[model samples]
Every structure is written in C-alpha cells, then in structure tokens.
Target: MTTDPKSDGGVTQSPNRPFGLPRWVIGVVPILLLGLVVGGFVATTPLAGVDGGEPLPDVSIDYTTLPNDDTIRLHVTNNAPEPVTISQVHVDDANWQFEMTGAGGDRTLEPLESATIEIPYSWMEEYDYSVTVIADNGATFSTTIVAANSSPGLTGQVVWTLTVIGFLIGIVPIALGIMWFPFMQTMSKKWLNAMLAFSAGVLGYLIFDGGFEAFETAQSVPSGYSGPLLVVLGISGAWLLLQAVMDWLTDDEGESRLSLAYSAALGIGLHNLAEGLAIGAAFATGRTSLGMFLIIGFMIHNVTEGPVIIAPLADGNRPSLVHFVAFGLLAGAPAILGGWIGVSTQSPLLNTLFLAIGVGALLQVVFDIGDIVRRTGSIRSAPNMMGFAIGLVFMYATGLFTL
Candidate 1:
C-alpha cells in the first residue's frame, strides 16, 4: 500500500508544526510579559512620604524687664483667622512676673491681630531668662532672653557650624549610592529578602510614628505648625519617582550591570541626602543622642542595602570583584555623607522633614529588594530571617523608636 508523505500509519503531521515556537519561547515569553505588567503596577504605588513646605506659626513676644530681674511680655500674632487665648505662662525664674495687659482677661488674642501681656520684675543683675508661653489652643512657644549673653560672635559661629554640617550629611548617601550596585547582585536571595523585610519594618514603624510625632513636636516650639501635609505629599511623590526609577532599571534584559549600578546609586543618593538633613537637624537642636540613634540604626540598615544592589547582578554571569567593591563604595559613601550632614544641622523642622523622606526611601528599598528575593528562589531562608530579626532588634535597642 502507498502511504501519504504527511502520514505515518494513521498519524498525520502538518509542515508548520516543525517551525512552531520553541519551548523556552513559549514559557519565557509569557513570563516576561507577565513580569512587565506586574512591574508597572509596582512602580506606580506610593510606598511612603516626603517632607516639604509646611506652614510655620508666627509668634512674637514684647516685654521690658530690669537688670537681673525678669518681666514677662507676651505678644502673639495669629496668622490664621481665629480667636486665640493664653492659658498659662511659665517663666524660668522667680524674679519675673506676668500679667495680661491687652484684648481681654487671660490674654485673648484675635486672628491676624496682636495681643500684649506684661511681666514686671525687680532688677537685680545680668542674667539670661527663658520664657515658656502656653496658649489655650494647645500652642506653645519658648524664647530665651539674653541679658548679658547676647554676643553676636557666638551666635554667628553656632549658625555657621550647624549649616555646614547639615548640608554635608544630607548629600553623602547619594554619593555612596553611585557605586553600590555591582556588589548587591551577588548576595544570596534569602539574605536580601531578610534585609528588605527589616527595612520595611523600620520604615513602616517610623512613617506612622515619626510623621505624627514631628508635627506634634513642631507645634510645641512654634505658634503655627506647617509641613505635615507637605510631609505626606512628599512621601507619595518620592515613592512614585522611585517606582519610576525601578521600572526604568528593570526594563528589558532583566537588571543589567549598568542599570543596576546606576539605579541603586541614584536612589541611594537621594536617600542619603534626606538622611543627612535629618541628622543635621537633630544635632542642630542639641539632640545628639537622638541623632546618633537614628544614624546607627540606618547604618546597620545600610550594610544590608549594599547586598541588595549586588544580588540582582548575579544573573549577569556573576559580577566580578571590581564591580562588587565599586558598588559597595557607591552604596556606602552616602551613609558617611548623611552622617556628616546629620551632625551639622540643628533645625528641628529639617530633622522632621528628613525623617519623613527617609521613611519613604526605606520603604522603596525594602519592596524593590523584596521583589528580587521572591524571583530568585531563596535557599537559606531561615538564616536570612534571623539576620532580618537581628537588624530589627538592633534598631529597637538603639532607641530609634523612641519619640
């Protein structure tokens, strides 16, 4: 019997079957397409907030006092339209006396208008006095009057020292980020996930706590606290920008050496800038312990950050030693800069804002790194989790969570 060329026994095959899609094309194409879709979604979500431009309160005090003896004078200008009243006034010393002299009893002040209260005291000698004023609306303001200590020399020096230090710490991390990538790609997926999780925990805790605490703290020092809204918006905006960067870095070819190097470095640079500002502000405010605490926790966190940058590069045929060290320096240098900046700035508001931005960056880092861990299929999950727990405990012990 003569059989057809297309048929073997009862089985028939088409010519087009031999040229059909390869197995990898069938599997990998779908996966790549899916990854692209998921990546887009991840990039758009706002992971945290930033700090900028919150309206500050305007407060002024007017008074006349005798030498050595202090008299309290309270004048408040309410920029916001509303009635304001003074509930109580506390003077640093007994030589000072306070009394309401304008508006109504108990020092009632109208919005956009100023009210005056006077404190009369007996003159003794040269002495500096601090005045604490509390308003009925839960606003508090404090000012120090220098009788003999009002030297322009010391004030200028203090301001200069703080300003320089603040700027340095704020930008250091960005510098470090430039070279952090090549090393991160070689880290085990398990360790990367652990670090990522730890970062997320720290940032999440800080965002909820730090953001609210900053606003409350600001209210204590100034009449009108402005900037909380900015903090929230900034966090969202920064997160979106980071998401954009992540999307760009993760595009076709799956995290190349150059893209990994640049994206991580840039993200870290911004992260360090904010960190520096925060540290500077803390030091400026005479909160050395608090500033140190923040830096130490972040530093531990920074060590893990290097690994995150390096691990993604593993797929590119295992990064070389040169790339590893270069990325490490890039990721680490910013921490140094951030540390210096933190030591300089003495502004409480700046610190608050910096904290907000830091929180945002940490969130982004955690999620971005976590994505890598999930894809890489971790082997040492337990040990990596231990590392993450250790990191968290270290942060808690450092008093970073203390308000």
Candidate 2:
C-alpha cells in the first residue's frame, strides 16, 4: 500500500508547517534587532574620540583648598602617556594670581608627573574659566571650571529660556508638514523622485562636507584625536544605531510603517535637543559665531523633519492638529537640552562628539523618511523634486555645506 501510494503520488501533499509565523512575526523581529543594534552603537561608540575613547590627553586638576582669604591651592597632573603643557590659565578677577613653579609657558613632562600651580586669589564670589593645556605631541585639552558654589540661578534662567525657545520653534515643523501635505500628495512620481534626489543631495553634502568640517574644526580648537580613524568609527557607530532603531520600530514584512515613523521622530527629537544644547552652550561660552551657524543650519533641517513626522500619521489614515503639536514638542525639546549641556561643560571633545552623533543620526533619518516618501507616491514628479530641491537650497544657502 505504501509503495502504491508513493508510486501513485496519490495526492502528494506535505504536512502543514506550524503556521511559520504571522507576517508580523517575520517583519518585527528583524527590524527590532536592527534598530536595537543601531541604538546600542549610537549610545556606546565614540565616533569623535581617540581609539573610541575621549580624545583629549588625560589631565587632572586638583584643588587643595577653597578660596578663603589668601590663596586657593591647586595641582595639575598629566595622567596620560603624553607630556602635557599648560598653555593658558584664565581667572575671573585680577585679584587672583597664577604661579607656575615649573616651566610655565611650554613645560613638558612625562606621563604620571605632577605640576603644582598655585592660584593665589581672594574673591568672595565663585568663578569659572577655561584652562587650555597643550600636549608635547600637540594635543590640546580645554577644561571648564565649575565652582562648588556655582550660581544655579543664572544657569537655571538660561535653561528655562532655552526650553521655551525650543518649544516654540518646534511648532513650525508641524505647521509646515500639514500645509505641504496636500501639495505633496498631488505630485507625480517623477517629481517625487526629484524631491527624494534633492533630499539625498542635501544630506549627502551635509555629511561629507559640513559634518567632516565640523569634526576637523573641533579637533583644531582643542588638541584631540588620533586622526581620521576615530571619525570613521564614529560615523559607522552612528549608522549602526540608526539601523538598529529602524529595525526595532519596523513591523514584519509588508506590515504597517507607523512604529518606524514614531521611532524616527523620537530619535529626531533627541537629536534636536542635543543640537539646542550646542547652540546655547556656545553662546554661553562666547562662541557666538559657531552657535549661530548651528542654529541656522538646524532650523533648516528641522523644517524638513516636519514632513517626516506627519507622513506616518497620514499612513495610518489619521491626522490631527493635537498629534502634530505633540510630535513637535517631542522633536523640539532637545534644542533646550542641547543648549544647556553645551553651556555647562567646557569639553571640546564632548561637544564635537555630540555634533558627530547628530550628523550620524540625521543621516539615518533622511534615509528612513526618504524610503517612506518614495513608496507613498512615485518619485518621478516635478513638484516633488522641486520641494526637495528647495530644501537642499536652504542648506546650501546657509553655508552648511561650506562649513
């Protein structure tokens, strides 16, 4: 009977494979895994560091006593393998005196050696300043002083202002997205393609030109980095994080794209906050030119980000003003945070690293949204391409590329 059945191929049929996995199961896992990996990389990888660590030479400044009457004692140590030289000491008041016992201007010492610098000053109010240190190997480190009795009032006010400004600016994206929705929907595929191409151009230019330049400028300001190796790693890590996040929020094959949209928005928000901090901090620390540049560049980028936020909502067949505002807030709050952080810390390495992360994250975002936009309508439309070109023009006009 078995032979007959086999030979006859009676109704050749295979046993059912336990419902492999719902479509969601297939799509969700890979996407989730990818996203998680990307997030991990973004969080952990030091793209702006030396050998994946903080780039500046390691040096410690110890204060022996608080400023009371006569003088405040402090000690500076070179902890890294390289020789560190004290380039400049900036104190607030003239009453404060800086005395370098050893070779002051360009003193060179091997790692683990200590130098005692006495700052004899009598001041009732607490103070802060930047001390620039140059390594024998030409690595520079700039550390900002934070007093134990630092005034939180001034700092708190600055933080509050930044938060308000960020919140306000965030609304623009939501508005722009809504206003342009009708226009984008009517565009032809060719136009759409043009738009995407334009978007790609802007992002590409920013990453290769603006992003790289920012990193170099950062390296120049305070001696940092072992070279391009760290920069490449940083870029890779950022991409990995972006991929991980996208995968995490994406559903199974052919599933809804809402989760990914949400995740991207969240990432964008976090990114903006970091940017805001950069602007605020630079202004706070007397880097107005740099701060202004970042603000203008980001503002343009944020405008484009608005459309990305709403695309998901549209896909779900639901769009509302309330949700728009909420997304705006989520996206915009970062400016304030970025501003505050930038102002608070005087670490050039930290600032530059954060900037690189922003660049990386933004690149991921452009790619993710571009994918969505293309699928919605054909990318072969004229208007759509024009829109994208307009966006790119903004970037270029702002000198984001030249920087």
Candidate 3:
C-alpha cells in the first residue's frame, strides 16, 4: 500500500497547519485575536470609563520661557480627568492679560492636553517671578522662576556656545582620563586587580547617583505619566536590553577583557550623557553658577572613569591607538548630543528616562566588574576591598563639588 510522505508514524499531518510559520506562531495568533476582541469590546463599551468621584480641576506648568524682555511664556498642561478652562493668569499676584495658543488655540484644555500662554509683561532679569494660572472651576496652579533670564534658543550663537561647553566638559575630560591607560599597563597584577575592583566601586557609586537623579527628575514629570513608574521601566528596560546584548556578544568561553573594557566605556558614556543634560538644563534655566559647578565636578568625576575602562584590558593585549580613541569617544561623545537636546528641548520625562537608563547601565557594569574581581581574587581580599572603598570615597568627594 502506498503511504503519504507527509504522514508521521501513521498519523497524517493536519491540512490546517500553516505551511511556513512556526507552531508557536499558530498558538500566539489566537491569543492576540482574543486580546484584540476584548480590547475592542472594552473600547466600544463604557467599561473603560472610571467615575472617580467628582471631576477636579488639575493643571501643571511644564515650563516657562522669556521670549523677549516684555514676554513671559508659560507651557501649561491639564492633568485633570475633565477638561479645564484657563480663566485667568497672575504674575506676582497681579492679574495679567495673556494670549492662549495650542490645543486649538483656546483657553479650554482637554484632559492631558497642553497649551501655551503668552503674557506681555516686563520681566526683570536677576529677579524671581511667581506665575499662577486660575482654572474656571476655581482651581489654581503656580510655578516660581528664580533669577529669571531669557531661555536659550536654538540660535547659532547659543548652539556654538553649547558645543564649546560640551567639548570642554565631555570630550576633553574623558580624553584626559583615557590617558591613564598606558600608565595602567605598567601596574603589577595585584594592583591591576585592585584597579578593577576600584572600577566596580566607582560604578556602584554612580548607580546610586544616577538612580537618585532619575527619581528626582521624575518628580517633575506630569502626574499622568507616573514619573516614578517611568524611571522603573526605563531602568529595567535598559538593564535587560544591555544584558542581552552583552550575553550575545560574549561566547561560551566567556566575556573577553576587551569586551568588558568596551562595556565599561559604554556605561560611563551613558552616565556622562546624563551629566551633560543636567549641565545643559541648568544653563537653559539661567542657573549659570550651577552649570559651571556641574561642568567642573563632572570633569573631575569622569576622569576616574577612564581607569575603569582600561583596567580590564591592562593585563591583556594592549589595544591600538584607534581602539583607545574609540573608547574615549564612546565614553564622552553622548554629552554633546545630550547637552544640545537638554538646552534646546528641556523635557523632564526625557531627562528622567536617560538618567534611569544610565543607572541601569552602570549597574550592569558594576556586576561585570565584580565578576572580574572574583576571577582575580576574593573580592573581600584586603587590596581589592580597599580599592573598592577608595573608589566610592573618591566619587563621593568629587560629587560634592557638583552639589
């Protein structure tokens, strides 16, 4: 008797089976279809709506800018569950006439919608101003601008200035730090291991530092976005993504010293990007002193990061000049882009997200370095322990200057 080749052990293949698709796809399709059906039903029905008592008027002043000496522009968002009408605006307790724009150029703002208010008032420099917005439902929201100055625009002069600042704080400092690579090569094996431990300590300190900054920045994000949750998601996503990439790059034999060095550079680079954003935001907000302080502090703080990148490769093959240069740029160039974006388009959510990602990257690097320290010797050993402690102390000392 002739038998069909498609039959397996007298069981015939089902004609309904997809020809080229995997079996998992076949299973997933039904789940997705069910989800879509349920989602459509919920969206079409009133089941998605929640009646959380009475609708309260809530609003947030996302940012304020001075377009000219006589103009005070406010970017406002409605965080209420119901639409809100901006009834009036007050500058320094005095009612001011303002022109509304955005959200259909009306005073009424739908839930989670944003609008801009332009008030033609003579705002003095080096002064503090309190701007308050009154809602139609008798709700009020206010924000204070300290030492008010013209917000930086995307003009050529401003861009050039930011570029110079970015180069000074980002590229120059990191390049100086990487200069330690040759010196690291001459250290003894024990000292090399200690340096690796130190790198971990530095990264450990940074993880906390970045995490704190991210959480702090998240507080400024709109309530609807759930800033704290965004930080959590950002950190988790970045950590898992980087961990996967690292795992894919490493072979069964294990992670190479060169790969570890590159990873350290990437982690430090992300941290520097956040620093750039902070500095840029400070400047954009007219906190020149704070910006300068951050510049100096980051320059010093980042110098220590160079050793972290090179310490892993010190005992192994010396990377060529191209690799060293690549490492420096990888660790520093993000600062330039970050500074520009932070100044030109200041978004608390974005800043918080980047900082969270940086924290995650640093966390991964810290563990990777810990593994190296373990292979070198017991991390609890005197030299390694001291190195780690010193790294934390040094970063803290440098960080104090920025604060």
Candidate 4:
C-alpha cells in the first residue's frame, strides 16, 4: 500500500473543503433551498393577497373584443352588499363618443351577479380608453379597455378553412418527434446525457415565458389574484394531476422511459395548444397574414419540441413505434383542440389556464431531466452544462425569429 505525499504516516489528510459541510449536508441542502424558494415566491406573490370575501358595492369589469364586429364585450360582475342599479356606461374620453345603455333598460345587478354588454366603435387602430361605469347608488369607477389586435369579422367558409389548415400545420411540428424512434443506439450515453440537459434548457425558457404571459394577462384585467391564482393552480394542480395518473398507469410495472416521455409530451402539448390559439385567433380576427406567419414561426419552433420530449427516451433502449405515436398525440392534439375554441371565442381565463398548465408540466419535465442527470452523475459535467446552455440559446433564438 502506498500513501500519497499529503498523507501523514497511515492517516490520510482531508482535501481542502470550502463550505466545510458534510457530503450528506451538501446533497440535502439543495432540497431545503428549493423548498425555501417555493415558499418565498408564494408568500411574496400578490396571489397571497387575493380576497374572495363578500363586498359592498364592489364591481369588476373585464373586456374582450367580439368576433365579426367593432364590438367590445364588457363582462361586469357586482360584488356589493345589496342589489345595485346601474344608470349608465360611457367611454371617459374627451368626446364621450362611445356608450352602452343598460340592456332593455334593466340594469339592476344583484349581489355577486354579472352582466355582459357590448360597446361598438369602429376604429382600425388600437383603441385605448377608460370606460366610466356608474351605478344608481353613486358608486363609480373607470376601467381601461383596449381593442383587440386582430380585426375580427366575417369568418365564412374560406376563413374557417384557412383556420383549420393553420391549426393542422401547428401540430405537424409535434408529430415530427417520431423521427427519434430510430437509432437510439447511434447516440452514446454521454450524448444522451447532453441531450437531456438540452431538453431541460428548452423547457425552462417555455415555463418562464409562459408563466409570465399568464400572469400578465390576468393582471391586465386587474382581476385581483384570480389570474395569478389560476396560474399557480394550473402549474401545481397539473403536476399533481399528471403524477397521479402516471402512478396509476405505471405503478404495477414501475415507471418506464416511455412514461417519462409521455409526461413531457403532455406538458408540451398543452403549451402547443396555446400556440394554436394564437394562430386561430389571428385568422379569426381576419388577420390572414399574421395567422400564416404565426403558423410558420410556431412550426419551426416546434421542431425542437419533439427532441425535447424524446431526449429522455434516449436513456432507454429503442422505444416501439406505438410509443412514439402515442407520445405525439398526447402532446400534439391539444393544439388542434385549442385552435377550434380560439377561433370561436377568446377567453383570458382559459388562456391563463392552458399556459399555466404548460408551465407546470414543463417544469416537471425539467425536474425529471435534472433527476436523470443527477442519477448518472453528469449534472455538473462540462458537457451537460454546455448542452443545457446551447439548448436554451437555440430555443430562444428560434423563438426570437419566429414567435
């Protein structure tokens, strides 16, 4: 037996330690830190301040552009202690040029009741204005209303056909993931490890951007914490929902790589649905140029998604063709479904829901990729970090030029 120069007789000297924490402490500390991060974000977020209790004469007004006209639908919800009567609604502009009278001269809204009324204004440019809502009891407030980006009108057969075609094209990128079905053997373990990290990076960006958009969308409506609350629920709830299903499906056989792939597919599918909504909405609003552009850009962006879902599968032996198709549908079908709904109507609540769900699911996939890399002791490797950064940059650049 030979002792190195650092060793004194038979006793070996310890390597220089930085934090001086034990190996187990170092390993366990990250989990503790993660918990703290989640806790802090929840505690500090505005969602914690959401009040759902009864109110006295409090009201909320949410607005969205109606299809096929220069009409804006104002959804008014009353949060008062008693029945309230609304006398008038006028755009608080200098000219006071736009107004909406109470429906059939019936404007009384019972406590916790809602009313939807339309305001018509023909302006090709984005109309930004404050609508002054008045109740007979003298409670009044002005809500900001912005016009829809796309011009929605007359979606006959031609527009409908184009919308359907655009939606189908959006799903094409998701299906492209099937190409990973072959030659898993060609990629070595190191290569697989790098790809998994790369997958994590791409998912990370989506989650960040998606979550932000969901929160911002709700905030725009000034709808208390409902938006952020819904987003948080979407993320955590979807995670729990998928986990329960995955356990039920694979508990007997234990989790397989295909199951993980399925999870990734499911998350990406929800996200892609949002993309489809964007395309459908553009065309539904009569913006053919923007709709086609979004489809093209999203299609290009989606090319990377297949590999994201399939990267984890590379850890296992070659997966069957059935597995690939199943994964594709699990992730890709939502886009088609979302397009149909988006074309008919645009709902902010639903938009936040899907985006949040995607954020949640995608986060889970990222965590899963991290677990794989950790288990293989490649998480901190240079190749792993390089792959992750490259993936993040590549996805971002694709998004920059396309989305």
Top TM-score prediction, candidate number: 3
Descending-lDDT candidate ranking: 3, 4, 2, 1
TM-score between candidate 4 and the true structure: 0.73
For model 4, the stretches where C-alpha displacement exceeds 4 angstroms are: 1-56, 66-72, 79-84, 92-105, 120-130, 141-169, 221-225, 251-255, 281-288, 291-293
Q: Where is model 2 more than 4 Å wrong at Cα?
A: 1-79, 82-96, 99-154, 170-179, 182-210, 220-228, 252-256, 263-267, 286-301, 312-316, 319-326, 369-387, 398-403
RMSD of each: 16.0, 12.7, 5.1, 12.2
lDDT of each: 0.51, 0.55, 0.82, 0.70
Ranking by TM-score: 3, 4, 2, 1
Judge candidate 1 against the unseen true structure and give its global Cα lDDT, from 0 to 1. 0.51
- In terms of lDDT, the poorest run of 10 residues in model 2 is 12-21
lDDT of 1 by residue, 1-403 (tens): 7776876555765554422545556667878999998998788755435454444444545222221234344445555555666677766733244677656555666655556667664433346667767766566767775552211222456445544443333323323432444554455655555655554444344445455655654443323435576567556766677677767665665554356444454555545555555544444333344455544455444443444454445445665667555655554445445545544433444555655565565556556655655666552477656655665665465544333
Per-residue lDDT of 260-362 in model 3, one digit per residue for the tens? Answer: 7787888888888887787677667766564666668768877888788888888876778998898888988888778788777678878988898888887
> Higher-lDDT candidate among 1 and 3?
3
lDDT of 2 at 126: 46
Top model by lDDT, which number? 3
* Candidate 4 minimal-lDDT segment of 10 residues: 94-103
Q: Candidates' TM-scores?
A: 0.48, 0.56, 0.85, 0.73
In lDDT terms, how accurate is model 2?
0.55
